[model samples]
Target chain A: MYQTNQYEGMIAETVSMRGHNGDVINAYVARPLGAGPFPGMVVIHHAPGWDEWYRECARRFAHHGYVSISPNLYFRDGHGTPEDVGAKVRAAGGAPDARVLGDLDGANAWLRSLPYVSRKVGIFGTCSGGRQAFLAGCRLKGLDAVIECWGGRVVQSKEELTPNQPVAPIDYTKDLSCPIIGIFGNEDKSPTPEQVNAHEAELKKHGKQYEFHRYEGAGHGFFYYDRPAYRQEQAVDGWKKVLAFTEKTLR
Target chain B: MCTMIAHQVRIQGRGKSGPEWFEVHEANVSYDHPYDLPLEHALNIDFVNETLGPGARVAVELSVDAARQLVKTIEAVLAQADQRGVLEDRPVAAEPARSPSVA
Candidate 1:
């Protein structure tokens, strides 16, 4: 069984952890102030880098009674604003898939080591982060739930394959250990409706426990309020679904 | 969508790094989500020198039409330069500036 917490306020701060072969990296952590244990979540930042919106997402998870940490995936590229580092990483052909997996493992370990954590941790991310969450959920163990928000390239075409991304996340569907929740927009072209359908089909074939919610009149990054793609109706519904899914699965 | 499509080119040029201009080694062009632009996607070009680190980059994100216009303008200017013998007058291998004041 899991423990309970009764904190009145939340504490959010920057912390450090070992990542990708014991290299120290910076991460933002947020959690409610409490005496009891709380479910943990690794909030993976999108390809935009660890920006303000990603920080808010971690805070939102903390507000919902989950201890959350958003790791700076591009820390190796050097730091000086999220956009700058993001561009550098992009220019350098992005971090390797193996490196990402190692960082996620480090995050998982960090969460489990926390004193107030229930050890029933989940992983969540938006955009590329969402894709990483799916990848980590399938490849890594110890996650109770996984939330993928508008992740693309899960079911990639031959033309879409790159040297860095040799395999599609859907190929790992058979090894998925926990329940997964996916939120997508019909207008998203990367993971088009057809691709989403293909991913769903693969999950079904593998008998994996998964739930997907597709929003109408929404496109990629509909949850980003600072961008033109923000869709309030769909974002609200998606948030509710995420909260409920984690509440049920992380217990 | 995280479009990982980028066309990279080896270039010898200059880019402003804060108050000073530095030699740039490469340019990356792609149509992807802009960091500050309001548009969902735009033509983003980054002038970078990896040796100078991540901060040594000058980036611009333009709309589709704007990007097309830029392409035409560049081509027209280069063609005009060639016609006027300006291209032939330029040095074949321009040397890097020894100091920031050279710009």
Candidate 2:
């Protein structure tokens, strides 16, 4: 798609919505200004908390003709900088999986309520959010696609499981309802190449529609430009794959 | 991978933030992604007093070598003080009780 001198407009802001157990929560929503209809995306922020990157990512999706919503998963953790809230969450052994899933469900519902929404909605997550996205595909309904980027602990040992994250995400593979795409760094420690392979085998056993793009010479959080893990070449290619997946499954 | 790795310990110290000093009641230590460090992961230490709000905190990120060196340096200094009879002989104390409302 190519266009010269095309008019462009967008609106980005924080909006309130009901999250898990009917609790009101804040969500960063970005939508194209002049849109007859647009696909929707629920952008789940990483474990670092609902910080700046996720907000910017919502705008990026809006630019690409999608309504994007990023819910504040740590809203109840209290008002503070991302680091402060994230540190608190980490100290508490992370947010409960049920609560996070409920929030994601609420975000999807809010997207569908929008007038310009195309009825197609997808979920994108990186880091801990990625793992939650995968869990959503299995546990939630109405999502068309799932984009899991470098989700660690998808395959967790029993001893590694916490009360907040009681069950291993791998156990939900057979329940996955939508197609999923995974982006990973070959050198990541949590989901090492072997773990990825194991996860792929589970998907294959369940015959799920899925695609995985693994990059060499990269490690966890390679897509994080602000961090030392950023790898331009791999990140670019991985993004292309992500967009392609969204196009095929969401658009 | 979001390591989700962190440990918290109670401590008693006064930390200065800007022009003001606040009591630091706890420290959180972890090996995970650093906000500003130029590495995949770093040993992060956060000195905090949650009652004083999120602003009453001091954070530092260091490489493994730096962290180990710092720990050894601290122990060495304490040992030197002990040898000089500058440190009082004290029994091990229990972890300080946190504010009941903190949770």
Candidate 3:
């Protein structure tokens, strides 16, 4: 049993699992206090790993009756704190897709093995986390739904300043076994309107169930409450949409 | 010679809902170099309006220079105390040219 913290009706717990080559991965799990099985959600962290805000998000989902687990993706590289991991990630250029995908697989396996978790599982992420969520939907088996918030780089260029290898989610639309909902700020520069449209077209071509919401006047990181770019109204509304989608797809 | 005092006001509200009313009270503070000027009131109003927008209903008040200085000092102290993290933080991606909105 994991030590639990109660917030509003949700129970938060810290857990650890083994990942690629037996690397220990740390995660925060939040869920309603109940005995029977419940729907589970895998919450992937943005570039900065396992920050307090992400933990609060897991608690919010748990309060809504879903089991949410947030995995610290950069733990394998000995990046413990957000600031430390952020610095190291910067020094290394950008996150390699191979490491990120392996982390997601380890997280998924952990969630599936939990006795309290139901067979229905979903994945959600913001920013870099959002990209991982899309990858999980297409690459991972048994995911019922995915929600991506402002996931940048649906198309990639090697010469770009960001140095992204560009694993376009559009290319994997045909492989998705479940619905994917993407939320973005119209003012965001990273995932510009053109990229969003390209992704939508790919989904349409594959006949995949998907929804895209764009908030006017909001910018990147609008959903982050601690940041100046936060748009409280838009973020709340987006959360509503995310919950509705998850319930519809997972239930 | 004139010394301009800078103040920041944050207006918070919920979705599509109108702005909630808030109040502020003036505090006594010493003005260095320049004693007082009429533009102070107008400048304060402009600052509040620009940051919070026109629809927001806000109460006006003066804060001491010491208060502002204290905040700066506290921020500096916090920054110095902050332990650096291992990961390097990157700035948000630069904005791209506007294209057609998705249907």
Candidate 4:
């Protein structure tokens, strides 16, 4: 794994593509500079908006030899500071699930269309992004794998369901088209341990290829080194598993 | 975990977002992650004029205790103003003041 000199480089930039209803949307693309085709990864930003952290996340995937695509799901709302747009979107009761799915589908297509792509793609998401990742894995046809890290609201109670999210994501388990590995914190409130168990049961019932890793003494957003919830040991191990899963499944 | 819990109400207020002050037409409140706070989550408040754009916002993140205390304090001040007959619920000018740079 160690080489003193390996030809290494990457290109990261912003690009526009068609999203829902053929509307053009912005997305960040990061890819290694070599000529051979590379595996693809779609990085869906959390509810915090498509901020700097997610952009860096795309680059991190590129560094690991995956072509990463991160779309600004809130682009239709407005553009400003990430926090401002995030707050506005939250106030409006989160980005419409339909819209996010459409944007993600578009991003996946754009990534597959790239000349340097391997045609296999994995999706990575945290918080609400995680929920969308799982939803996409079920609703979209081409995703090869899913890394759903601490996604909440997948098992919504009838009361928790909103007009925008009329059905629970778990209800779509039968449609999951790819193997999925989940990263969850035991202490997470939204998807409590029980909800995680329920999600597992659904997968088991459907006989879907899936795995879940639960971390003790950690809560939501454990990989966000920028936040207080970051757990060094857990995040390190989790990253190893995520990269391994992507490699084994997509590469 | 993103609760996706938030509510916005129309309000008349002036808020200083960054260096300049602007007229705020809405107050959005929620319990969610904060942009500047160190904790996992907070009771967030946003004073904004959405028509002016996303930047027309002054945001605050407070702990649960702090948010409750703020609500009680606001009630107390309003009660005192009401008892003293000094409350000015209506604006002196029918038209609200506007900020040129903020707009």
Q: What is the DockQ of each candidate?
A: 0.50, 0.41, 0.02, 0.71
Which residue pairs clash in candidate 4? none
In CAPRI terms, where does candidate 3 land? incorrect
Candidate 1: residue pairs that collide: none
**Candidate 4 segments whose C-alpha is farther than 4 A from its true place:** B91-103
Most accurate candidate by DockQ: 4
Location of the lowest summed lDDT over 10 successive residues in candidate 1 chain B: B94-103
Q: How do the candidates score on chain B by TM-score? A: 0.84, 0.82, 0.24, 0.86
Q: Give the higher-TM-score candidate: 2 or 4.
A: 4
Ranking by lDDT: 4, 2, 1, 3
Using TM-score, give the best candidate's number: 4
Candidate numbers sorted by DockQ from highest down: 4, 1, 2, 3
For each of the candidates, what fraction of the native contacts does it recover? 0.55, 0.42, 0.00, 0.75
**Is 3 or 4 the stronger prediction by DockQ?**
4
Each model's iRMS: 3.0, 3.1, 20.5, 1.6
Instruction: Mark the regions of model 3 whose C-alpha exceeds 4 Å error after superposition.
Output: A1-8, A158-166, B1-103
Residue-level lDDT tens digits of model 2 in B22-68? 66888988887777888777898888887766656678889999999
The order of the candidates by TM-score, greatest first, is: 4, 2, 1, 3
lDDT of 2 by residue, A61-121 (tens): 8888889999999998877788878877776778899999999999999999988999899
How displaced is residue A126 in candidate 3, in Å?
A: 0.5
How large is the C-alpha RMSD of every model relative to the true structure? 3.4, 3.5, 18.0, 1.5
